[model samples]
Target: MTTFPVEQIRADFPILQEKIRNKPLVYLDNAASCQKPQAVIDSIVHTYSHEYANIHRGVHTLSVKATDRFEGAREKVRAFINAASTKEIIFVRGATEAINLVAQSFGKSQLQAGDEIVISAMEHHANIVPWQMLCQQIGTVLKVVPINQQGELLFDEYLNLLTDKTKLVAITHMSNALGTINPVKQIVEAAHSKNIPVLLDGAQAIPHMAVDVQDLDCDFYVFSGHKLYGPSGTGVLYGKQALLEAMPPYQGGGDMIRKVTFTETEYAGLPHKFEAGTPAIAEIIGLGAAIDYLNQFGMAAISAYEAELLAYATEQAQQIKGLNIIGQAAEKGGILSFTLDRIHPHDIGTMLDSLGIAIRAGHHCAMPVMDFYGVPATARASFAMYNTRQEIDVLMQGIKSLIEVFG
Candidate 1:
């Protein structure tokens, strides 16, 4: 087992100390959501307790303070993804909403009848459904790039799908269901070769690795703050400056308008055009603090530690009889999805929970991938920097007990 500063990190999250059925909590459901550190919790409380005011429409001191904090969070998001400017970052409720915003605004503007929009088989419903809805609305065709049995995208098949008729290609940087880390840089380059713009669903990638939007050259990237140790109900969509300016506004409300007129109303620029009414002021501030907290730890260190944890868990899991791990992508993130012989994934999840171990069991919002694998669901254990080898041992023991009981 690799030695991580697990004790030191565990101390930062108070919720990890709680007991279930008199057993210490072993949180392995990080892919669903991560426990927040004190820094993030305190930041949220501080924002609401000390400075709570509506932003961008008032002249009062509190409003000014709120606006500054809110916009500062935008800058933090820009820096987090290495976006070119704050204008490229638009805050929404979560990755789902951010993706819908782009699909409705940018997609509606770009796609026409018989136009093609490509996505991967491993895409979450949030990434797939929005494009499908848009395609249905505009009479466009939605194409899916197939994945191999190992759950890795078939890049050659993806390349073949790109053509002059392809208007947009939406894909996931990392599969939330399978833990497949896709070659997004190469994917983007290939799509751009055919003049197709790419939108990356980064909900799974942002929390696990360092993402440089400029380096990837993707047209749009979306991720949720909750998955990155920030507050819930907060997310960001980063678009290239030109694309954001060209796309129409998502929602028409108070902040999105430049001037109100019955005859003709002008829309605000880049971010404001997308951000409608009063935003998630406190959550945005907390997200900024979360970014600050992660920066202090250094993303390189976090990535390395999570990779080690994943490898250790994989080795331990492979030792169990009648166990089959899914998504054996050459490049994977911190997620481990698997199944046991004749045992439903939901049963495995419930059994683990009895031992104070948390995991995700379902299609994980990627029903296509599940269908491709011919499985109803999978039990997923996702690790973070705070997870320890002891937790993995507990998980392994829990699985062994389950096998003995069910076998």
Candidate 2:
């Protein structure tokens, strides 16, 4: 087993101490949502306890405090992705809303009849649906880049699909279902060469590895805070300042507008233009704290540790009889999705739960990818910084028990 302070890391999350069915809980569903640290929880509680007030409009002490806390979170987000300016960060509900915002504002303004938008076969529904809606609204065409049997993107196929008519390319930085880390820099360069803008769905990538939006030069980058060890109902959308300035406001509300009259109104600038109404103030503050927590342990260290865990898990899992590991990408994150012969994924999930081991078993919101593999779903066990090789051993034991019971 690779050396990591797993016990110390487990202590940071209080919920790991709980018992399930008289057994110690082993949480492997970090991809769906991570267990929040005490720091994040304390931040939310502290915000609600003391600094509860509406932001931006009020000039009073409480409002000023609220505004400072709220905008402070924005700066944290800006720095997290290495965005060009605070103006580039727009707070939204989550990655779902962020993609929808781009589809609505930028899609509406730029996409025209017969224009084409490119996406990958491994895209989540959140990334695919909004673009489909846009294509349907206008007469735009939606094209998909196929993935090979190894669950890696066919970059050559993607290149072939690119044409002068391609308006935008919306691709995931990492595949949520397959754990494939895409070559986003190369993808962005390819799209830019065609003069087509690209938007990266970064919800999965941000939590696992380092992401530099400026370095990638993607037109827009988006992620959710909940998946990054922060609060739910809070996410960020980072668009180039020039692109945001050109697009219209996503939602019309009090804060998004600069001046309003009976006849006409003027929308606010970049960040505020996209963010409408009273925002999730406490959750935003909690996200800032979560970022601070991640920063304490550098992303490089976290990535290296997770890579070791993934290799150990892969080697151990391969030793099991009749086990089939899915998505064998040359480059991968810490997600291990697999199937056992003649056992349904849901059944495997339930059996593992009986052993106090939690793993996700479903289509994982990428039905198209499942269809490609000719399976309804596969059991997924994703790891985080807190996960250790011993946990993987427990998972393997649980799987063996499940097979013995079912077989």
Candidate 3:
């Protein structure tokens, strides 16, 4: 009986009070992006209203205040993931941009022609596309480890894929569409045995569970703030100090230079070298506030609570006749994806929306996973800390109504 302060958690998110189509909003699209709590919202407002200034290169009062908040956010991110230093935390636009940065900057140098980068079959498009682009440019080959029908990675096949030619192994810590939690620590150990670097896309993992980069021993980790109940256009990329020093700058512009000249320009340090332009300053502060909000409840308790919710949803889902559930990985996060016998996913989403239940429908940016399952799309209901089992019951009722309507 792991207890959770469910009602108190729900009240913190003002948007939960929203009424959609005259029905109360039941938000279950957490894997895409989580709803912000009032703390995060207030932080964003405070940053914009009180301390809005470009970070670094400015010695003015507001600039220093803004830079403190911005860099303070970086420190929060560092502590959140247990990174060694603030130097390793490079704020990017989102997980998409974070992966792109590593691919162009680190992958370019580490991988030559005929080199291989290994990824899982269930990777999101954000994880897959950048490596493909890198391979296309450098003549490197991308290797994909297959997944079982349960959506778990084939570990033996992954081990087989790691040869001397393997340069990097990039994988998602959790599958956004499938909710499958990968064996990342084991994956890192296997890759390291071959002297291969590994990167984790933590966009789906951070909000649901506690993450420690040092314990995982992954060379790089990336996550988006928006998925962690923060704001859009804000993300964090964590790289080892040694790797970041060796890698070239992802982009060259303001704040990334120690000294600039007509002949030879000197680049700045680890993090600034990767961050090329003006960042999402206010959003970064909001992200720090989001971290604060989560810490109050603690991730362990949240994970436990969500597990109970997931179990309830899974058990209830089985009772719906003609409903086919996808991604039955034994160990998973709180995501439920399904397809009704005669209903398109888009229609399912629309019908659910009319009842004020928010769930995602489509390929979910993991077209490869969808193709593997032989489905065009699925309706996904992803849970957050604020979600309730009662909401799941409403969803079941809505789904049953759809079956009756279709019949």
CA lDDT of each candidate?
0.92, 0.92, 0.94
Select the stronger candidate by TM-score from 1 and 3. 3
> All predictions: root-mean-square deviation over Cα?
1.1, 1.0, 0.8
- List of clashing residue pairs for candidate 1: none
Predict model 3's lDDT versus the native.
0.94
lDDT of 3 by residue, 1-407 (tens): 36799899899999999999999999989998999999999998898899999999689999999999999999999998999999999999999999999999999987899999999999999999999999899999999999999999999999999998999999999999899999999999999988999999999999999999999999999999999999999999999999999999988889899999899989999789988889899999999999989999889999999999999999999999999889999989999988888799999999999999999999999999899989999999999999998999999999999989989
Off by over 4 Å in 1: 1-4
Cα error, candidate 3, residue 230 (Å): 0.4
Clashing pairs in 3: none
Q: Which 10 consecutive residues of model 2 have the lowest summed lDDT?
A: 1-10
* Index of the highest-TM-score prediction: 3
Candidate 3's displacement at residue 113, Å, is 0.5
Q: Write the per-residue lDDT of candidate 1 for residues 9-45, one digit (tens) a residue.
A: 7898999999987899999999999889899999888
